[model samples]
Target chain A: MMRQEAMGVLARANLEELRGALGAWPEPPDAESLRGPEAGLIMLRGRAGGGGAPFNLGEATVARATVRLSSGEVGFSCVLGRDLEKARLAALFDALWQREAEVVDMHLLTLVRERLAGQIERTAEETAATRVNFFTMIRGEDE
Target chain B: MYVAVKGGERAIRNAHRLLADKRRGPRNLPDITLEQIASQLALSVDRIMAEGSLYDRDLAALAMKQARGDLIEAIFLVRAYRTTAPRFGFSEPIDTSKMSIERRVSATFKDLPGGQLLGSTFDYTHRLLDPTLQGAEIEQAARADVTDEDRPMPRVTDLLAHEELIEGDGEAEEGAEVGDLTREPLSFPAERDLRLQTLARGDEGFLLGLGYSTQRGYSRTHPFVGEIRVGMVEVEIEIPELGFTVSIGEIQVTECQMVTQFQGSAKAPPQFTRGYGLVFGQGERKAMAMSLVDRALRAREFGEDVVAPAQDEEFVLSHSDNVQSTGFVEHLKLPHYVDFQAELDLVRRMRREYEDRTADEGKEAAE
Candidate 1:
C-alpha cells in the first residue's frame, strides 16, 4: 500500500513530499511545531522573505513551514501568504500523506487540491494587480 | 436521471489502466528491443548521450525506444535519470592532441604535417538517393597504410604560431572554477564559464538555428573550421589515496576548433581567435554548431558590440534546455480550470462595473 501511494505521487509529479523531506525549505518556516514520521519533532521557522531570497521592509510577507510525519517523512513547505500556521499545517498534512498512505482519503485529495488551486489563483491575482501601479506615462501631446 | 456517487479510488484505478494501455498500445505486436534501437538508430542514441550528459549508449538507446523514438523525450528521460546517479569524481581532461586519428581534417592549411585524411564524411558525396543501400551492403574500399615517417600530425595552430597570425596561448589560469548553472538559476550577462555550461546542454536545433542566423549576416564573424577531429581519447582520474592517476574506460569524442577573424583593438592585436567545441561520440554537426556559437558568444571578451540573437547571453541560456522547454510547453495539458474560473469571474465583474458607469453617463446626457 505504501509503495502504491509512493508510485501514485511520483507519476502524478506531486513531488512536494520528496522535496520537503529533503529539508529544502526556502527559509526556516515559522509555524506551530509539528511531530513528523521519519523526522523526529519538527517546527517551522517562518520568516517574511522573497522565497528565501533577501527582502527589505515593505516587501510582501512569505510564509514558510516545516514538519515531520510519524512514518518518518521530514517535510517543509513554503507558500506566499501571512498564514504561517495554515501553511505549516498544510505542509504537515502533505508529509503525513507521504508517510502514511491511509491518511490520503479521496475526499482529502480533492479538498487539498481545490484549496491549493484557490490559493494559487489569489496569489497570481495579487501579483498581477501589484504590477499595474504607475497610471501615468502619458504621451507628450497630453502634456 | 438520478446518478450514484462514483468512488474516487475506482476512477483513479481506471485512469491508471488507461494510461498504461496507452503507453504500451496493442501488446500483441512485437516488443521493441533496446539493442535494435541502439544499433539501427545509433544517431538518435548519440544525440541522447550528447544532451543527457551521460555516456551510457545502452541507456540512451533504451530511453529512445521507450520514448517511441522521440529524441528530445529520450534526452529528458536520461537527464532525469542522470540526476539520481551519484557523482564519484571528475575525469582528467582527455588530451585531444594524442587522439589516434581515424578522421582528421583542416580546412585552413593545404599541406600540413598530418596530410588531411578525408575519412568518412558526406561532404564530397552527391546527395543522391541510392536505392541499392536500402537492401545491400556496398563493397568495402581498400585500406591504405602510410609509414610513420611520412605521416605528420602537426596542428594548424602550429602554423599560425609560426606566421604570428594569432596571439600566443597565455599561461593557464589557476584554480578550477565551479560552474553555476546546475546549482543556481541562470542570470543575465553570464560569465564565460556559465555561458559555456549553458551552451553544452542547449538544444541542438535551437543552437543550429541561431548559428545559421549568424552566418546570414545577423552577427557575422567569419568563421572557418580550423580543425575537426574525431577519435577515441583515454580517460584518467587521479585518486588521492593512491597518489597516482589511473585509467578509466575510454570514450569517443568529436572535437572542432573554429578560427574566426576579429578586428584588432588597441589593447590586443587581433588575428585569428579560437573557439573550442567537443561532444561525445561522432557528432560533427553538433560540434561545428557549438564551435560557431562559442565564437559568436565571445563578442564581449573581444570588445565587439553584441548585436544579434547568437550574441545575447540571456536569450541563449534561458531557452537552451530541451527538458525545461518540453516540460513547460507540454504542461499546458494539465488541469488549469480553477485558474480559468477565477479569471472568468474577474472579467465578468469588470464588465459589469464598466456597463453600469456607461449607463449612468447615458442617462445624464439624455436628461
Candidate 2:
C-alpha cells in the first residue's frame, strides 16, 4: 500500500520534478513491454450529489503505459492527455519502487510527499480568502 | 421499361468537383481559417464536442471546417475520428461541488449560499442582427471588482436535502462496474448510466421535442430547475500501480438538476425526485432539455403508467441519433430505379384492365 501510494504521487507529479527525481536514481532494470503508451478516452463517473448513486459525468483523454521488470514485478503508469514520455518515466519509477523499495522509499518517496504537501498548502492558501461565515443573533423580542 | 443507370462514379466525381468550386466561391474572397471557426463559431464547435462525446476544441473546429459548418455533420466527423482512438484508464468522478463556476443559477430559490453569478450569457441579449459586427474590431472589456477567491460553491439541492424534502439518492455498491454504451449494444430497460450516456450524445432538437412533449401534459413532473451550472472541473484518474488517483486535466461541462414533486407511495413518503443532465461543453439548453426528458423516462421506476412517447425508453433512445436518422432519410435519393420500375409496371397493367372494363359496360348499356 505504501509503495502504491508513492507510485501514485510519482505518476501525478510535475513532469520536471519527476524527471529530476529520476535523474538521481541509478540505472533502471531491464523492462519488458507489457502494454502501450497509447492515448484514449475514459468515462468519468460521479455521484448524483457527491455522496449519491454513481452516474457517468463525462470522458477525458488519458495516456497509459505498463512495463514489467525481469524480476516479475509489474509497473503501470497512466497520465492525463498524450504524454507518452511522462507515462514511461512513471512506469519505470513504479518498477524501481517495487524492486528497490528501501532505496526509493528513503530518497524518492520523501520528495514526493514534500511536493504533495506543498501543492495542498498552495491550494489552501489560494482558497483561504474566499471562505465565508454565516451567523445568527439572539433577539430580545422573543424573550 | 427502365434502363440501367451507368457512369455513377464519373457523375459523383464531377459533383465533388462542383462542390469544391462552390466552396472556394470565385477565389477572390478571404478563405475562412480554422482559427476563426475555433473562436468565432465556437458555439458550433462546443455542440459538436458535446454530441460527438469528444472534448478536443481544436479537433471539433477542424471537423466544423471539414463539414462546411454543418454542426451535425461535424459531430459525425468527430465521432468517426473518436472510433479509432484507444481506451486509456477511466477517470475518477468529477466533484462538481468543487467546480470553478462561471455561471450558476437556481429557479427554486431566490437567494442561495453561493449567490448566482450570471457570467457570460445571452439571456438578456436582443435577437436583432448587428450589421456593425461584420467587420467589427473586438476588444476585451475590463470588468470591475474581479474576486480572486477560489472556493467550492454549495449546491442548492443540498439545502432541501438537509430538510429531508428531497429524496435521497441511494448509495451505489462499491466496486460495481458501470455499463459502457460504446462497447455494448443498447438493450431495453437500460441502466441510468447507459441512459445518461445516450442522452448526452443524443440530438439536441430531438431531446427538446421530447422535453416539450412532457411539458404539454404527456408526462408532467412539475419540475423546477434546482440548479444549472456551467464551469470547469478537474479530472483525476486512478493509477493502480500508484494506489491513488491524480489530477489529469480540467474540462468545461454543463450540469442541470431538476427537482420534481412526487406524491407519497405505499413504501415511501412524499419527496422531491431528482433528474440529472450533464454534457461535454457549455451547453445549457441541451442539458436542461435532457434533464426534463430524463425525468419523464423515469416514469417506470416511479411506478407511474407510461402513457407518453417520451416515457418510452426504447423509442427515445433508438431514434435520438441524428447521424443515423439523416443517413436513413437521405438514402432515399440513392438509386431505387428497379423497385420503382416494378411498381410502375403493376400500376400500368391495373389501369389498362380498369379502362377495358369501363368500355365493356358502356357497350352493354348502348345495346
For all candidates, state DockQ relative to the true structure: 0.01, 0.23
Model 2 TM-score, 2 decimals: 0.77
Candidate 1 lDDT score at position B248: 30
Instruction: Enumerate clash totals for all models, in the order shown.
Output: 19, 2
Most DockQ-accurate candidate: 2
- RMSD in angstroms, candidate 2? 6.4
Give model 2's DockQ, 2 decimals.
Answer: 0.23
Residue B363, candidate 2: how far off, in angstroms? Answer: 7.2
- How do the residues B228-288 of candidate 1 rate in per-residue lDDT, one tens digit apiece? 8776555544545335554433456677777787568786565887665667667888878
| Candidate 2 structure quality by residue, lDDT tens digits, B1-367 | 3345687798899989887777667688888888988888877888998888877787888888877778888888988877888766567777778887777778777667766666667776898889999879987532333344434677777767778788765577788777777888899999777788788888999999998898889988888899888877777777665566766556778888888867687878788887878887789889888989888888888888999999999999999988788878877777788989899999999999999999999999999
lDDT of each: 0.59, 0.76
